[model samples]
Target: MPKTAIVPPGTGKPLAPYVPGILADGILYVSGTLPLDAEAQVVHHGDAAAQTRHVLETIKGVVETAGGTLDDITFNHIFLKDWADYAAINGVYAEYFPGEKPARYCIQCGLVKPEALVEIASVAHLGTATGA
Candidate 1:
């Protein structure tokens, strides 16, 4: 199967061995995204709500670059540093997917960057486009 890396503008190189997203067989597999600023430092400090928003926006860029919208997302994998922030994260997350919700799972776990309170990865399908 052929695959293409989905890298939007201003993505600034990641410090790992993976691309932001990969498009394979019309399915976009987004890597776990962190709430990091341009310098790759964690953002929002100890605020999980703000960090969740940033992570979602970063995922938005990857999905858009793959020619898909947030509504096209079928699943999401969310990781949180603390379960106490679950409600706050969901509050901000609902705003992004206001319509039909996607299949998802959230868990409390340690992230690659200790300062990052939340991380998210998603899968979206952008069916082959029809001719204009």
Candidate 2:
């Protein structure tokens, strides 16, 4: 049977979507997180690097709620409104996944929200199956 995990909305930050995360089988799928604060307002204005860090931090919370760690991340999908900010984004991304990096794909496109420059979603392995 499959189970679902719920990431409670953060306090003093912003009211994250009621459904922040969900897990199925051994895969934990996190929603795209932006640099929005507790009030659902964007923070770290005009700084792509800072925004990226904020988004990643939010992802960390979601991952933990799903009973997984950053090391368990297997894949990451990044959406960016400006390709020119790739270097800045990478700087922040490296800080989060310092050693073993997950498989990632970054694309330049229009984000659903105007103020959001980048949004990241991830899939992680939370089960114990491993090669002997």
Candidate 3:
């Protein structure tokens, strides 16, 4: 199966050489998304909840562009700048992934940007290959 890079219009271009997501073999592999705007500058500053929302929204864009939805996500890799923001991040995260949640693991670590409180990478299965 040929792979396709997923880059939705207005999504921030990362400093690194990587696409926001990649679709191949019926699955979308979303890269670690940070709370950045279209210019790739971090947003929400110290607010973990808002940062989580931004990150998830970015992931939503990637998956949606690749022909999937939040419900199609099967797993997530969450990264946090501080453990103190866990609950706050989860609060916003729940809003995006309501019921049966995807498998995820979060860890405290230094992010690419000091102001970025949360980052998330996701995997979504569309079940069938799209011409993406």
Q: Which stretches of candidate 3 lie over 4 Å from their true place?
A: 129-132
Alpha-carbon lDDT of model 1: 0.90
By lDDT, is 1 or 3 better?
1
Q: lDDT tens string, model 1, 57-104?
A: 999988888888899899999999999999999999999999999999
Worst 10 residues of 2 by lDDT: 9-18
Better of 2 and 3 by lDDT: 3
Residue-level lDDT tens digits of model 3 in 1-132 = 688898998766578999988888898899988899888898887889988988888888888888888999999999998899999999999999998999999999998888999889999998775724
Q: What tens-digit string does per-residue lDDT give for candidate 2 at 29-88?
A: 877777788787878877889999999988888887777788999999999989888999
Candidate 3, residue 76: CA error in Å?
A: 0.5
Best by lDDT: 1
Candidate 2 clash figure, as a count: 5
Q: C-alpha displacement of 118 in model 3, angstroms?
A: 0.6
